[model samples]
Target chain A: MTDDKDHYIRALFDISPAYDDAPVFQQKVMMGLTLKSWLRQGLVVISGLIGGLYALTQFVRMPEWSLKGGGLYTGSLQMATRRTDATVEAGVEFIDIMARGLADSLFAVGGYVQWMQTPQFFWVSFALCSCILVLYLLNDAQERI
Target chain B: MPQSPGHNSAQDQSDIDLIGRAVTGSHTAFGELVRRHSGALRTHLRRMGAQSSDADDIAQETFMAAFERLSEFRFEGPFIAWLKMIASRRYLKKLKAAQKYLFTDDATLFETPDEAPPPDMRLHDLDSALLQLKPIERVCVTLNFSAGLSHVDVAAETGLPLGTVKSHIKRGLDQLKSALTVPNSSSHPIASSQNGAAGSATPTFMDERR
Candidate 1:
């Protein structure tokens, strides 16, 4: 009789609001699956690009520190004056002042950049990007389990 | 052998068969599985004290989560049971998230027993009765009786101690019995489809009890 009561209660409790799947539900799931795959690929590409940029910044020849010698003075003067209606003398003065300030700021950080002279900076950048990519993939993989 | 009331013993594709196809990247197979089980899952959520719309939202999350991990399914039991397990977890997470905002006394909620319902008053009345139960009691009762999970399974899913689950079920059943059995002259909280037509009629749960 207890079994009967339990069974009867189960039947009564099983009564629920009837629902049918809206086509939109299926559409949403499929769209989500697509978005998830695309995001995975996109993250990989973004990490690779970041890694490439880091490598380039480390290996490529950056501008030398001389305000007048490195292309900074000529480049800024031409850029500010050639494409504008500004007087050449005024443009050269403006460019020279701006270049000097920028050079001073860069020189302020010269010690840190100098310390990064070895391949350590490249490896650090590589490691950071790789760690980010691995963590992302691991999160996705864990979700599957 | 007599099958359970809602068992779809004669369906063309068994859940295992459908799951097999789903594992091979068949969206149609998965969609079919969702269509097959979503109603029961939604109902289970509703029984657990979720408002109608919230239940549907949780059902959506449950299905999406289940699909992502479809390959992990071992097919050792009924697929509906597995779906229920996932839905229960989602519901618990939702309850945890909402704990900061809502406060209601289960004792106060059930204080007004409301008039006994008509003998034939079905779906809406059942929902109304369930609404009177405390959220945890409702979950325990629905999981054990409605969803057919064992006490251990309910405990495992709900993170409630086994004794607590059993106590909730016992107390819940008693309240349900009274709510459905005693046909008092008091006003019913939920508007019935019959509108007090079956005045002398036995309540649905009492009738089921006999």
Candidate 2:
């Protein structure tokens, strides 16, 4: 019995893992996970969408269109040139028009303004984020209540 | 992945740094971070007493929670503590849900590794003996023996006062000896050698020897 006990104890010290595959399997499940955050989940989604759009615009669209297409490329929005030189009128017009359009859209859309921005996609994104935050707050309040 | 690109012990510092960046909301940084700590955390979870079946799920939950709420983390020391905390909570919550007592000697909760013989005996009798002790005691012994963590590290990990950790270790050793020295009755659960030994003994319950 003494020898048996000793052998058992010794085996434990040299013990290999019981489940060799467990760590790998678990980690796969954990991929891309963050612990938790104060950031609202819905807000993250909305912000992510807005930011993604902004990036897509910068990388995918700016180089291609801001030239002949300019701010009026879409045709409905009109924007004033910021500089005396006409060389970059369209670029300046693009920024100004986007700003004004998004502002007006916010008022026109009211609560849903986030979904319908008239200006540059950036403010549309900002408004969308705001909408998400508001909705998150409502749900959060309901949870608390 | 099994581990991270850089952390194959290729460069622990670089991997840790990348993980820090991930915690800061860098998507690629987080990807590297996940690849780095996930394996060790899973292994640690299994060692910490999670069942093999649940270990993966628990590990996943821990990482996800860590990634999503990383901004709240303040890396005052090594980030392992944070990861450990996440894994610990996930495992502890499961234990709580099962109504298993974390502080007590509960062998039933830990599954037996097949490499070892006997249902009650742990793969290593020593670790098994340590497990038979109380939770804090088990933690001290594990850190000291398995992880090679110092008493100070144990205190840090367990939130016990430094001196208290030492005392727990001392007292835990004594009780473990008391438990182990008793003559093995074949019918006993530990004697059955299934999960590596439960934490009790028999006979005079006092008359024992090496």
Candidate of highest TM-score: 1
Candidate 2 runs further than 4 Å off: A1-27, A30-145, B1-13, B103-210
- The pairs that clash in candidate 1 are none
Q: How far does residue B125 in candidate 1 sit from its true spot (Å)?
A: 5.4
Which CAPRI category fits model 2?
incorrect
Instruction: For candidate 2, write residues B1-210 as lDDT tens digits.
Output: 487664444334464566667666665665556555555565456556665557667767676666666776776654545766667655655665676655454556544344533455522244355545666566565455434467887777666689978987676656554545433533322232221122333211111111
Superposition TM-score, candidate 1 onto the true structure = 0.62
What is the model-wide C-alpha lDDT for candidate 2? 0.52
Q: Rate the local accuracy (lDDT) of all candidates.
A: 0.63, 0.52
Predicted candidate 1 versus true structure: per-residue lDDT over A11-111, tens digit per residue: 55544333333445556666776676689689889978965765555564445653223444345554555555557667677767787778666654553
* TM-score per candidate: 0.62, 0.41
Error of 2 at B19 (Å): 2.7
